[model samples]
Target: RLERLGARFEAASPLGNGQCSAPHPLTVTALADGVALEPAATLNCRAAEALARWTTEVQVAAQKEFGESLKSLALGGTYVCRGQNHDTDAKLSEHSFANAIDVMAYGFTKRASLKVTAAPDGTPEAAFLASARTGACTFFRTVLGPGSDAAHGNHLHLDLRERNAGHRLCQ
Candidate 1:
């Protein structure tokens, strides 16, 4: 499926540290049509698939909002062994299992890049970001970004954390 989406990636070594693990991990460098993931991303296949699917929506939103194609994604992180929100006593984060991605910014083919910070109201960047965040809920079980919390104010935190009764958290 990833190949069908034109995503360039390769299988990675199994990852784990007792508390967190990914049996089948992947390192993705690009999405559809050469849309790069800046610095690439290390993720479980399920998370990578969700990202691949969401990129289509992002491309559409970019075209509609800025009349430009997406060039690259400035990613903040993919897999990290840490507690949620960096609190040592909190539950382990989806990133701890290679099942989450932090997106820091969006790069365009013909427009200035837009960071995932608060954009002015009514601006194209704001609308584009809103569209991206909302669209992500369709693919990711958890979609957190600016306004969700101070910890997530500068990046979109997407994850595939399962929940009771198929509930989703899109904040």
Candidate 2:
């Protein structure tokens, strides 16, 4: 599906903790003439389903905001980290169950990382990050941005937290 749309895909780290079937979202980038998918740990059934929904929404939002200019997605893949915003005790995060995807970073260089949330002033990175935030609210339940805390400074936290649980945070 991605290739047909000129998307590039790559498999990244796989689960090693011997937990579930290596559940985590495959980080992807869909551009105007090419797409990139960095396959990460592994995604559980629920998260996988949620990602599908999120992907669709992201595409529409990018086009709506950029107009035929599919913003370059640069954040390779979701990191399967031990939970906790910041702490060694950050045990298996929701991502361990493939319930979360950390958008480490994105690329608006070819375009413009909109000014929103952390940026708001229209810095290049900020603008790109903004589009992700602006468009993805409906796809994933929890969206955490830079001001969300030190742990999330460089990434957009997107999680499939059902029941509207946890912090519906946007930093």
Query: Who wins the lDDT comparison?
Result: 1
In candidate 1, what are the lDDT values of residues 1-171, reduced to their tens digit?
Answer: 999988999999999987999989999999996899998999999999999999999999999999989999999999999999999999999999999999999999988899998999999999999999999999999999999999999999999999999999999
After superposition, the stretches of candidate 2 with alpha carbons farther than 4 Å from their true spots are 1-34, 39-41, 76-81, 107-117, 120-128, 163-171
Task: Quote each prediction's TM-score.
Answer: 0.98, 0.61
What tens digits encode model 2's per-residue C-alpha lDDT throughout 3-66? 4444333444555565533533343444334333333324554554455555555656556555
Cα RMSD (angstroms) for every candidate in the order listed:
0.6, 5.0
Per-model lDDT: 0.96, 0.53
- 35 in model 1: Cα distance from truth in Å? 0.9
